[model samples]
Target: MRLTVRHTTTYRYAPPRRAVVQSHRLTPSVFEGQQTIWWNISVPGAWTGATFRDGAGDRIETVSMLGPVEEVLVEVTGEVETQDLAGVLRGHRETVPPTAYLRTTRATHPDTGLRELSADALAGADGDPLDRAHRLSRAVAEAIAYVPGETHAHTSAAEALSLGKGVCQDHAHALIGAAIAADMPARYVTGYLFVGDEPMGEASHAWAEIHVPELGWVGFDPANRCCPDARYIRLGSGHDAQLAAPIRGLAQGVGEERLDVSVDVAEAAQSQQQ
Candidate 1:
């Protein structure tokens, strides 16, 4: 299946700033089950400074903003081709070795509540790795309410687990923590999900992928309680949300400055030709 994606982000500052520097990881790459046909990014008040690939092989770009800038906007548009590999990705594969996904700065220290999802909980389960992981994901989803503003990006998986409230990011992290504790290799995936009959909303989405020895990396979106389909356009993979964040940046001057962010993910309408 083919999909077209449009992601737009805007940053507004409380007070006008002198300059700004930002890093972006909004580009998608072709993987075992997906292919990128075309992708491009545009920044209204920023200029591309440099581009490189990060440790996880994600495409990264740096942008510089001019002085007295109060707002910055970035837009990404792309199309990808995807195939359903549910059957092939179901079982484990021996060829793919198990490896720990490197931790990110924010996802490091577990919050007080998140510690309960340690290896012990996973090992205690009486089932195969795949079955265990599926059960764990479902449990996390059912346990947590998809509440906004209840948790921030830095909230730990343990905290989310205990609070029983969080967005998709928290669910993904909780599932990852549980999988890792279970002695399974799991990674964080950031992307956009087609809401289908649900209401359109702000921002992209987040999910988790576990590695089965033979199946390689298989995705699970606990927030949606299903595997990713053609509507999903993967952006990057890492240990947690911070690593796959669409944007990160620093500035030279700072004094009582407030940060504001807005994100939009929409599906492109079919063209007349199509």
Candidate 2:
């Protein structure tokens, strides 16, 4: 399968600003099952500073803003060829030790509500790890009915779990919490998932990935009960959404600023030859 992704982010201020600085994590990398054919990024305001990578490495570039710049736009366009490795990925990868993923983070804290419990206890009716994880993900998806006004990026997993409502980000966090509690090393993955013929109003997507002793990192979309298959395009990984945010930065001046973001991920009509 081949995918073409177009991600654009723009910022507008009430009062015109002289300059600004921004960081982005929008580049898609070629991994075990995917290959990047061509990729590029464009910034309308001119590249003040930038970083690029094919997922495993990094490169940096810096440029200065013209003048009286009020808005900044960053666009990334790329084509990637992916192979179907469901069978291969489902099995364990002995080369990469499972213990490598046990390290903890703020979001994966063992004391966090969901992470406090063991997977065995959370399994309840289900005994298998995968089964337990799926059940928990589904429960979260159902419990947190996708309400737009219910949550935001800053919403915490414990808060969402307590409120019983939120979006994919919240669901991912809740799932991560549950996995950590179950004694699983789980991490947050920021990416895109296609809904086939179904129409979606949002651009980017979020899901959780757990490291099973031998199986390595397996993706679980609590929002959509299943592993990420061909529709999923991973951008990066972090302990939580904030750490793996696509774009983040700090401005010298302090006031109140509004942010507007848009994303588009679609399967290219033609698949690239591997």
Candidate 3:
């Protein structure tokens, strides 16, 4: 499947800031599951600082703007040919050891509830690592209801689990926490889901990748109750959402800022024929 993506994020500061700097993980991941066709990222009037691929195989780019900066726009347009590899991360090069993900961050820290949730999820499973991982994902799915506005950017896995509702980010965090409690190394993935050609307020997505002794890292989306198929586009992975954010930045001065994001992901054929 060929997928096309358009994502735009705008940041507006109430009072102009002195300057701004940001790190971006907006490029798609290269693996057996997907190949980039053509991709571009544009930030008007900003200088491209540094670009490198991190240990986790994610391409990172840095941009800086000298202000009186009132508004900044980040735009991304790309196309990728994807395959259904059953969520397996194959033919990907990365130097980081999977065990590194066993270390939890603030957002994915497991509480007693998360530990118990993992235990219950694995009760019916045997010794297969992949099977246990799938069960863990299912458990998270049943535990958290997918309610978009039930949570916010700062919601942690424990908090979301207690509430029993959240969006994809919450589901991913809950699954990551539970997997860690089960002694399975897991990480958060930031990506795009092909949700059709219709304009949407958001198209970006999140999921968890569990490291299995037999299959390496496998992707799972508890919120959607399935593994990532051709419809998904993997971009980057980190210990949690904040670390995996597509755009992470800071300004020189303190001021209130508002953000608006719009995304559209469609099948390349469908987009071209229209």
Q: TM-scores of all models?
A: 0.81, 0.79, 0.97
Rank ordering of all candidates by lDDT, starting from the highest: 3, 1, 2
Q: What digit string (tens of lDDT, one per residue) describes model 3 on residues 1-274?
A: 9999999999999799999999999999989999999999999999999999999999999999999999999999999999999999998899999999999998999999999999998986889999999999999999999888889999999999999999899999999999999889999999999876434223799999999896899999998899999999999999999999999999989889989999889999989999
Error of 2 at 108 (Å): 5.8
- Comparing 1 with 3 on lDDT, the higher-scoring candidate is 3
lDDT against the true structure, each candidate: 0.70, 0.64, 0.94
Worst 10 residues of 3 by lDDT: 194-203
Backbone N/Cα/C clashes per model = 11, 6, 0
Higher-ranked by TM-score: 2 or 3? 3
Give candidate 2's error at residue 267 in angstroms: 2.4
* Candidate 1 local lDDT, residue 204: 77
Candidate maximizing TM-score: 3
